[model samples]
Target: MSTGTLYLIPNTLGDGDEAALAYVLPAPVRERAGTLASYIGENAKTTRAFLKRVGTTRPIQEIEIHELNVNTPAGEIDKLLKPLLGGIDTGLVSEAGVPAVADPGALLVRRAHERGIKVVPLVGPSSILLALMASGLNGQSFAFHGYLPVDANERIKKLRELEQTSRKAKQTQIFIETPYRNKSMLDTLLSTCAPSTLVCVAADLTLPTETILSRAVSDWKKKPTPDLHKRPAIFLLLAH
Candidate 1:
């Protein structure tokens, strides 16, 4: 019997707006997603909603969705791949964006590789890649740090370290913050980095309120900061 394939599925970055979903995801991806009956997701509710949007032929209630999140123990991750070992292809979906890239699904993918199961990643919108593409920063050499520290002092220290790294290596540093803490993160960035450094803040990507702006730290200070509170955003810093 052949081992099953592990499909790394991607979901919309923003709220489930049909137009945005249609524009970002291709028909082939949606069609394939709809055919799968077994899945592992970070959040079950969002996973069902996404499956429905993709036109899944299987009844939402009937689909097998195993939850994988930060709370999931490393030892139990291997059990999640049992369906694949039994020759049943399994789909892995995250709360949003691509699975396993800065997402909890990475653990499952790593285990799949160890078990010699086929791992396939489908095409989808990644906020990290989209922000890099539009930021006009050093995309050729960049790093995504996921999220910065929430503590004020620790966050400032991390910002300085990233700034130094960006300047020394000419590599763009990409990171994110919780939606509600977006404004506070922006304040730290403005105060911690040098005035000449460039900061790109891409907020509400793929949504009607989408905004991607890259400007010097000094310039950002001169203008009124955009209200980013309660908004999903990606931040990139480059010092050339």
Candidate 2:
């Protein structure tokens, strides 16, 4: 039997903003997701919600869903691939953005490649790419550091290092912070990065409340970080 293909699905950035679904996701992606009978996702509950929006072809109860998160052991990923190995086409999705990028499931994708299972990625909104596009940064040579150190001092040091690297490499350094810590992250970034360093804060991407601001650290310090509290955001840095 031909090994089944694994589809990498993209989830919306907003929290249950179903209205934005048609705006960010293509019809082909939703159509393909609705046809899949199996899925692997970081959070089953959210994945179910996503499928519901996609209007799955089969009854939701009949579709099979498996979990793959940061907590999933490396040894267990192969077990999750059993269905695909047996010719069951499956979808891989994350809580937000595309699967296997910032989220878990890269291992599953790698394993699929080794086992000869085809891997396909569907098009959708990715906060990282959206932010970079709007930031006017050096997208050609950029690196995405999922999340910086959480510790205050450590995060500051990391920001300095990223800035220096950006200057030397001419590469855009991108990172994200937890919603609740957005203000603190911005504060440290403005304080730690050089005055001329270009900083971008893309918040609430793809939603009606979306905000994307790119400016120099000196200009950013002229005013407050703009109500970033409890909002999903991506930050980009390009040192001069």
Candidate 3:
């Protein structure tokens, strides 16, 4: 009988390491920290810390760290995750929020399924679902378009297309961009979508000063917009 396990880990939202210990494994597994596997990014320090909280005193070798790339091919993802999938349990995590929801764990999960590996999803905060919950938009039918294009002209064209598609399909179009580019994306949406279009901006999600506001495209002119560079944000466009 071949027995292996993969634990999907979620990074704490906003709060620091105080709650991390609760998310780790028990004492003896904590003693086998080195045997644990970590599937996170190089810049994912908070996530790495959470894993260490579980592994405890385990040897570093047991603590395998698989560097995941959101843009990589499935074959490449399989190559990087071979060991964890073959014998050891793999832990998939995003820097924040649940893995595979606009995170890099989709390929891992799909590959694991193809290999007949058992998978488990843990409880955690997901910025997307949280935003949708608060946005007051149609949550039943929504699509996450991931990050938008950086090129201004192309972005406008794509937004126009999405606006039409969203309206016709009766689906909410959700997307995000780099924090620095958020303002520009907002501007494009305002200019591209119909004046009656409903747009929602969910900024600094899960933080102390979280903001989830939905308003008409024409009404957006009535209030001050987020500086975007000051904080991270996600945008949702709905047809109402």
TM-score of each model, paired residue for residue: 0.97, 0.97, 0.82
lDDT of 1 by residue, 22-98 (tens): 88888888888888879999888888888888888878898899999999999999899989999998899988889
Q: Show model 1 residue runs off by greater than 4 Å.
A: none
lDDT by residue (tens digit), candidate 2, 18-110: 567878888899889999999999878878998998788899988899999999999999999999999999999989888888888899999
Go through the candidates in order and give the C-alpha RMSD of each one to the true structure: 1.0, 1.0, 3.9
lDDT tens readout by residue for model 3, 1-240: 453566666655555453443443234433333345545452455556666554534654445576676566666866755665567666676776677778777877787787777877766677777778888888889899998788888898889888888899988888989877878888889888898889999987766677778999999977888667756688999864
The window of 10 residues in a row where model 1 has the poorest summed lDDT is: 14-23
Candidate 1 Cα RMSD (Å): 1.0
**Candidate number with the higher lDDT (1 or 2):** 2
Roughly what TM-score does model 1 have, to 2 decimal places? Answer: 0.97
Error of 2 at 43 (Å): 1.5
In candidate 3 the C-alpha lDDT for residue 181 amounts to 80
Q: What TM-score does model 2 achieve against the real structure? A: 0.97
Give lDDT: candidate 1, residue 217: 94
Q: Kindly give the stretch of ten consecutive residues in candidate 3 with the minimal lDDT sum.
A: 24-33
